[model samples]
Target: MKTSKIIIYDEPTVPEIQIKKLEKFLHDTFHADTEIRKNFFENREDEIFQEIATTRVFELKKPFSKHIPTKLEIQIEKENIDNSQNEEKILYDGFEFQKIISKFIPSNENDQEILNIIFTNKLTCTFDESDFRYHARALIGTNPAIISTTGIIEAPAKPKEYYLDLMVNFTKESAEKIKEKYKGEFLEYNDSRITEVVEGYLLQAVMYYETGEAFCEDRECRLYNAHWQKELLYTQSNKKLCKNHEESLRKIINHS
Candidate 1:
């Protein structure tokens, strides 16, 4: 493997992401030394929080521009609030947030062979020029990878029928009923299955760092880039990679 070490920062607000299980999973998968840290933003200076708050995405239809954050916004970051659990969601520009985070990483640990992966409950989004809109992304690929727990639940499209039901009902109660009807079909906040679902994303980050490819086209593979909730559930259910990726994994380890 190209990566010799991986440093994972935890999101304590989301207890479903058990840090030790993730640590063990990476060790078993790659035999790479792993270390866990508390939330990356924890104990950061007030300016760091204010700077990060400036990266918030207010207009999903437009490209990123620096936001003059409200006092509440900076306070939210300082408190390490998990807004993903609330109905009113907050979005941040993924790339911009990554840039701010990169500035905080120590100079000594800035090696290509050491992967730094951060887990957060914040929703991270990227602007797509093709669509001219910002879209939520579950994982952002790079040296210091970001895994958004909120994005994992919200990014993928839900069942079509669920939306159709809401369209016809058009009431809060009806929406809740519809959600309950399709509950198991998709992930929700604080879902127990998140622990299992996150493993697939971890595999994606690791494989991307090693091979320069972040996803598989095959739906049966764990590394498949799933755009829909059902696709995510199905691909992760397989609990394995495609034959080609399996071979690639062998080569990655062998060459190392």
Candidate 2:
């Protein structure tokens, strides 16, 4: 492993993430020292909040253009609030958000040996060149990787049948009923399965830093890049690396 230690920045709003349990999972799985820290956005500078506010994506179909944030938006950024608690969704450019987080790291602790993973309730998204549109991403893989708890629920596509059912005579109340009907099929806010799903993302971050590969093609693999909610649940809940990833993991650990 290129990283000697792993540090996780917690998202306190979502207690279902179970940060301490996640720390234990890392130690038991990788045999590495893991540390947990408080929320990353807390106590940040006014300028930092201004910078973060500019990363929000208002137009999904278009590529990223730096947003000129309103005073209210900047103020919203400054406020220490659980963003997920609100019904409205806010989107941030994942790479831009990662860059902001990278700058926030203390220089003394910023090094190859230290792997920093930030857990955020904000939805992080990336613009796809092929589709020419922004798409929510659960993990933004890098030195300071971001695991967006909101993205975990929103990124993956829900069941096709559910959407089909929703499209027919859809009303706000009807949509609520549809969501209730298929509640357990996909991750909801405050889902207990978040901790398990996050473990997969954490491993992907570590493996990306160590081996330069962040994802696998196999759905059975914990590192699989899942586009659908069912696949995400299946891959993460299994909690086992595929043969190739298992071998790669062993090699990385042994050689470290």
Candidate 3:
């Protein structure tokens, strides 16, 4: 006879807005009266095989997004192995379960502005847990997205025991994109400071357009700003070149 063991570790912080969104997703996807119960783990016991899932939402302040992003993490542990092949079978089945859950999330919206503004932008997503090991540093776009699980599976022949640890992250990016797409669209900005700020932002946008890079560090830059924005000059003593000159030097150095 063979025996298997599964262990899951979860440590997530969810915000209120994303919690509601996740609940809606669950209700819509599963058609189940899914109520996200808090403090549900207080009754859990050790060495008992169980399936556990948790959801969390977080709001990132601007330069990122006004609306918060939602995250869901799930863990499933099972025991009792009867054969040598049971370990492989469990891993395959676990991945299949992850796939099914991934399909339940939403997709990016069809709106062009929304897609261009949000879906095209990239965001960082992270996955790290002790029991399981699959983790990635970043992901692109949003709206019902699935982050792959990571971790190790150990099956010892002599001990006749199998251990599987897995972690998966799900996010809703589409709705957040839609909300940000048109935010402040109709708001009037008559203040001179606001206008100047807008102009500066436009200047940065133009720089990005001409060079295929951002003027600031908010996003990746294909070319340095010094080379791209010749009109402005600021020196970096470390590089012994002004910002404009530094970027130009970078181009020169790269070309050479």
lDDT (10s digit) by residue, model 3, range 99-118:
33234222442221111111
Q: Residue-wise lDDT of candidate 2 within 103-180, one digit each (tens)? A: 989997789889999988788999999989999998999879999888889999999989998889599999999999
- In order of appearance, the predictions have TM-scores of 0.95, 0.96, 0.17
Candidate 1 weakest ten by summed lDDT: 80-89
Estimate the TM-score for candidate 1: 0.95
Instruction: Identify the superior model by TM-score, candidate 2 or candidate 3.
Output: 2
Off by over 4 Å in 2: none
Candidate 2 residue-pair clash tally: 0
- RMSD values for the candidates in order, in angstroms, are 1.4, 1.3, 23.4
Q: What global local distance difference test value does model 1 have? A: 0.88
Pairs that collide, model 2: none
